[model samples]
Target: MDERSQFLADAAAQRKERELNRVQTETTLKLQALARGYLARKKFVSAVRSTTSEKFSAFVDLEKSEKVLLSNDEVLKWSRLFLRILRLPDDNEVLALLVPDTSYFHWTPSRVISDIISTIPQSLMYISGNRVTENSLFLASNEHKPLISGQALNALFSILFKSVKNDENLLPIFISHVLTCPAIVVHLNKANLDNFLNSELFDRCLTYLRSSPELVESIEPQKTINLLGNVIHLGYLDEETVKNRIVDWTWVIGLVMAQCTEFAVRPGEQSSHNHWHPIFGHYRLPIDPKLWKKLGGGSSSEPTHTAELEKDIPPTLAAIVCQLYMTALSTMTNMKNEIIAGICREDRTLRQLWSYLVRWGNQGRYVSSSSTAPSPLNAALSLMSCPQSLHAAPLMLFADAAAIVISILDEEELYERAVPFALEELVHIARFCNYFCFRAVWTGYVDDRSSDHGLFASIHQLCMVLHVRDSRRSFVNDPKFWLAPDVKSSILMGEFEKKTPRGVLLMRRMSHLVSLKERMLLFRKFVSADKNSNESSATLITGLDEAGIDQDGVFKEFLELTIKKVFDPALNLFHSTAAGVLYPSATSSVHEDHLALFQFVGRILAKAVYEGIVVDVQLAPVLLAAVRFFIQILLDFVVCN
Candidate 1:
């Protein structure tokens, strides 16, 4: 009883202490706010008073006030005062001073407001002049260029870009003010827009972004990207011209892709079970180990600090990155011409984009598996329902951008005009699609899913597109490139992992070792028994005669022999290419039982793949193309219904 009483008392004391700290913190904050407000108001009044020599007491009078007039110098002073005061911390009483209270001053508010708005672009022009003059010192004085000389217009971009690092909403505030100005709307023609884009300030900003990767999402780059987005939105340039300019300015896209690569690649080990989906429970398929290693994934040792760096990325920094990159992609992609071809002409850019896709596509698996992650349902729903929330969490946004570029890369005409994708790149993309699709299926099945179902749809579309294009193009049966055993294996099995029923089979000596027909019949009966059975979660095992247990060697031998015989020219089921790889016979449809024979052989091959057995058989690109068509058809049916 004494121990219980002591425990209750201690808990009560802790709660009282917490309450006291909360009240103290709140009180301190309120005092700080009051002090800041007083200081800002005093500064505004002093600056305003120094601008005029008239009896200001009469100007302050509500009833006895006459019209208060000001000279040009006085109005400029007031404008500068207002702009300076705007830089102070936000306070309602301070902001209220910007509007001339008619009863207090009897002055025209619209005239003053217009003056303040027009002074913004003038300030930017002044800065641009100074920067250009500084740059000209190293060159000939004859090379001097005049600054932007235009009618005064609202250009809050100067204020936005020059804002202190602590000011978070500067761009939004700038947009809000400038968007309401009639001059800005009327000045949306090409020449005026070009001045903004071609300004020395704009050029300097581009240089800064290209050179300083660490600060790519900082004030200057933010201003540059937003400036470009506005110009694009105004439709001042024709689509082709805009696309050409973007191609010339491809480094902006490069910056975005580089940042994405930094954010996506995590250090340390990747678990084999990272793809597990709770909705699908234990039925979720595991990734193939060989394929995982080929992608530069899976377990590895590294300095502990590398993992720490990933966690070090601030939410604010990541949010800025997502916004900037999305804006750039939206602007570039909106153009009618093929921008991706220009952007991905280099291998580095292509790899960066691919890395982005691989990382973000499976982010759901990461989020779901993480203990510190937000609730899967809440996170997924927020991303779908709120654009702002989605912006803050860039996982899906990164995937979507990468998908757009990749879909463009899939266009055959783009390759013909630009550079053909490297062979390994094609293989990697196909492999990733297959694995991504499988994981997507499990996510869709689970109620607490993580990944976007739209990604699955995109992959489905890509598959069909690639298949149709391949059907029209002649197969390049180059034997030298196809000779590497491992490369051929990855190409054939990497694109599609066929689903097969799992069960154990015990075969007598005569049927398993000798006759092809007998082996096929035996395997057919074994697979048929597993159709309605709940044995899919089990590993497939083959048993030989009583003297020898199959462990995996016997099964591998059986698979190799069965596949070789099935694809032989004597069987007339498939034809051999110059590369010595097998392709489905074009006239095989003439045989009544060809389809069934092919299906049976496919099932056996799938089982071999499921068990991680490497058979010597290689499939030609034409056959792989047909496989892609069927897989896409299956996915379309699954996703649609």
Candidate 2:
């Protein structure tokens, strides 16, 4: 029985060994097939690389070598190789491959080529570290000139929208590159912009902006706003289209306001003081005697020559832009209060927008002789005067907006139409001037010291505007004109009557000036009495009883606040140990912050004197305090050393 069992076990072991051998044989066959296939693919890829390189090299160096004209099948093969190698292509290799002529073939298989081109932008979105994709797309547009056609632009826009949708951070770079591409601009210039605006791409962009409020405030939106400006300039969209698209108008206004707010205040380091730098001084006119003589001899009268130099000319691109903004403004019916708030906010975006509108309108005035310069101030006033609106709301809203506008105007331009408009419109002017006074005082205490000069200059300009050279024409000569009981009441009790402490001070000053109308009458009498006198006149007092009121008290308080808010912080910074160390070849330990304060205080004092806002006697204490502070800083530095 044992012998029989052993014989069965041997047979079973033999059968199992045979089964293992059969499985091993199948595995070896599969390995052999995979190796053979990989080798075949390697050889094919090598051949494709060598052949494409040779052809592209010949094309790029055609001047040195014969032009290699490939057949359609050969070109198609090259395109297929590019598609396959799209994972990673060498820079020199791809540039040589994507020459102007070779890029033309990319569009032959329209659907396939479009799919391939679309992938590039996606690849750009994903593999941000890769330069090949960006280079490939740029080369296609720049060197190959393939993106000029409507089909190509549409494809590019689709790709851009998709990529930006996926990663919103890429919106600015994508918009900047795509919208400003020379080919795209050229195409849009000649092509119908309305078609592009009406396309799916435009709709997608509108949706994107609507969805992303953060994007509306960023620098990215400027590109879109600029593109729209170009479209309007090119006359692609008519008035109706612009008006009907509330989304587009709101987006643009928000963008403009955002840009304005961002750049409202010039950086302290880049302030106008830098214009006096040695390197930059060459660009400025020298203060030579001859230049002064020439200027003195020039016309002292108003600028009689309008900015328009040519008559019968068509409206300019700037004029069209102005018209577009005006249209947008008209449609901003519900946004009027928001717009006023934006203007009055410290960001100064509204002020910057106002300046841009004026600058563009002025530029347009030069191009189209018949076109009137667009005035943001005028537009806001017109909105205020709109018959459909309640009078009180518009009046208060526009009063604030006008204050911001007036605060930023160039000193020379202050007396132009703005002052005249204020003079003629008594109800609005009273409110406007009241706000202006508040701004003047608030800015003096809160803004940079250099800016105080402008405030003083503006005040001086206002005084000049009110000066009665001709008594018959002077508004001040007529008590009913500016000093009406209703106007005085409105000025005193308006929305901003005592909103700020500084505002209260301003109102007090205004109240005193308005209450003493006899002083204005006396000044008018003195002015008319000595119209021919070349001698400097005496200070015109309102009256002895009123003069006893210490108006300088407000100015003194303002200077004290400036010392506390601006000077003390600077003094503390300057007295720090880090500020005591001198750089090589330095003469003193005084830092720029200290010097800036000195210059700032000097300018304020000088302007105060010039504007007759404060006398030297009143400024003496402020100057003494500044000098004593500087002396203390110097003593600290000396003792530390």
- What's the CA RMSD of model 2 in angstroms? 23.4
Error of 1 at 434 (Å): 0.9
* lDDT by residue for model 1 (66-163), tens: 55545546766876787777755675565444322311324334334333444443444344533432232112111122122122121222222333
Cα misplacement distance, residue 450 of candidate 1 (Å): 10
TM-scores across all candidates?
A: 0.28, 0.34
List per-prediction Cα lDDT, in the order shown: 0.42, 0.41
Query: Which candidate should be chosen as best, given lDDT against the real structure?
Result: 1
Model 2: CA > 4 A from native: 1-112, 119-124, 129-173, 176-195, 198-200, 216-241, 260-472, 475-481, 484-512, 515-641
Which ten-residue region of model 1 has the weakest summed lDDT? 501-510
lDDT of 2 by residue, 98-125 (tens): 4332234333243444344444555545
